[model samples]
Target: MFKFNETSPRKCWLIGHRGAMGHAPENTLASFICGQKLGADMLECDIHLSKDKKCVVMHDESVERTTNGHGQIRNLTSSKIKKLDAGSWYSKKYVGERALLLEELLDWIKEQKSCLGRALGLAIEIKNEPIRYLDIEKVAIEIVKKKKMESRIIFISFDHGVVKRAKSLEPNIPTGILYREPLADPFKRAKELGADAIFPRRHLITKSLVQNAHKHKLFVVAWTVNEVKEMKKIFTIGTDAIATNFPDRLNRVLSNAVKR
Candidate 1:
């Protein structure tokens, strides 16, 4: 397991948000591979249960935005979802990339680790909310356990119940709450829900917020920050990690900062 507690103040983690979405199609295997190749310390992706109950990798509940197919993810069977063109919308270079099953991605990650000789972290966001998919958390947990990547994976969600359920099912797996607006006592809210971390929108992150989270033994991971200036600011404020659409850009900023 990648230990968030062991992170140094100066060394913040650069997480690939939706597998370097700025570079490749979001939530596809190609994008995740691009993120790893670009030196991301961690990668983040969204998961939703298909009609047939298989875990599918996609950020949107609907496939219209990211794929050649249209309709809610839960309404489509894994066979139908797998046949959609998931990459052409992004670029011709990624044309044949299809939506990946969660298990497929996990297997690929394990192979990558063996080749790299290091463990890579993954933040999986459960997208079952407003219309809950029954036992999605349990299914996801079982998959992670089967892969023996429990320590390398962290579960996060905008739904408080989902976060709570994840912790309840597997207390050892790190869970987090994702919020966009400013919350009163964010750390306290997260702690009360049994979350180990708080994932806030980039602009919502402040030095005081990071300090407060650390004070409560909760880590702060800011999301979707792609600009060099914003990356530098978040780094200065000392977030535990910055989730970005461009891991390469963040890596460059970190390298320059180190040189300076």
Candidate 2:
């Protein structure tokens, strides 16, 4: 259901995880902007709805790690969340950065995609559970639909239940299954969830696993691959994309190697 841009190369796509997190504060607008400038094909981010049902961009359940504020993101209003300095804790240069609403991020992506003449997409990881939040799937889907980005948005979640719920809400929207451990059959799990993609840790992507996942018509994307040697292994394993913090390194590697 998730179609990549026609202009994208056949080789592994390089997505900037948490918006080139290695270069800037993770999950902040500054980081996302910098990643886009640094040649990221897709910007990977986590999304959670605020108390007022506004989609907010963040990585952690708690704000204390990345922002000046402390508490659950859902408990805070847009105005209250905006007031916290999200970047200063990471570096002084990023001191004034604040949490970006999903709408704001989508606006920035629209402008960037137009300016760059490329198909920029969002790999949104849903961080809420229905048990924890009343209607996370409904709110998340509403925002993406409102932005008209359902075509470009890939909904991913570590929680399989959430992924299933998303698919139920909008069967047309593409979804991905995120995993940290080696499942007995990742392919089966993905198929069960109706996922278009299977996102797993770098070490878990074996050659056989890739082949099996692709056989099921699931795009396989390995996460946080930053080293060149490791990158090569993933390529050998045949992933559809590699989520990395160093897009520049991946670009340089590709530039050096000319396919025979």
Candidate 3:
């Protein structure tokens, strides 16, 4: 449902990595709000299933890194996870910010889009590795459809099975594959997984790689690009999208690039 702008000079998307993680706590509402205010074309967030089977916004399988709590997210219920202080670790000024439910985040996005008079895209990365959540793909798809947000979001995963499963469940939904290593033929692999896009780590992207992906009709979105120089390099390489921890910085880069 998320379409790339063909007419733009760069023909690249500026996505907020973990909702402007450089400005606010990752995966929190504050960070997402900051990204939206900074004019991010899209917001990228990670998802995990709680012990109670609710979809929760978190990048890690455990809360140790991002929150004041310690434990596997799958071991905790939504109520317990919501009670933890998700922002203090990043800054005391954001002392009371809590992790958001996927539904809550979607609602916030919807509200922001209405007020901003523009559509905001979302990249939802499902965290499934080592230990897979039962039916997470199905549940997440159901939630997105219920929110009527199927058109505004795309599913991405490091797991090929997850990407394939998501596409199988909903043929119309767009899916992307996330990989860090150099693949022999990324386009072929992505096509095998039924992915419309491929998200490679910044270092793995090359001009030939982008060209090949584009040749196969697959969008190439580089992940977690933060520095100005690195952003410029990726832009010059012609990636279809740049995912960054600082959406404001990416916006400035895009603006300057367009002017030049």
Predicted structure 3: lDDT: 0.87
Instruction: Quantify all predictions' global Cα lDDT against the true fold.
Output: 0.87, 0.80, 0.87
**Cα lDDT tens digits for candidate 2, 147-200:** 888877788998888899999999988899998988988888888988888999
Identify the runs in model 3 with alpha carbons over 4 angstroms from their true place: 1-10, 114-117
- What total of clashing residue pairs does each candidate reach? 0, 0, 0
lDDT per residue for candidate 3 within 1-260, as digits (tens), equals 24742434435678888998999999999999898888687899999999999999999999999999999989999999999999999999889899998988999887665112458878999989866898898999998899998878899999889999999998777899999888888899999998999999999999999888888998889998999999999999889889999888888888888777
The segments of candidate 2 whose C-alpha lies over 4 angstroms from its true place after superposition are 1-10, 114-117, 129-131, 258-260
Clashes of 2: 0
Each candidate's TM vs. the true structure? 0.95, 0.92, 0.95
Q: Name the candidate, 1 or 2, with the larger lDDT value.
A: 1
Ranking by lDDT: 1, 3, 2
Q: Mark the 10 consecutive residues where model 1 has the least summed lDDT.
A: 110-119
* Pairs that clash in candidate 1: none
Worst 10 residues of 3 by lDDT: 1-10
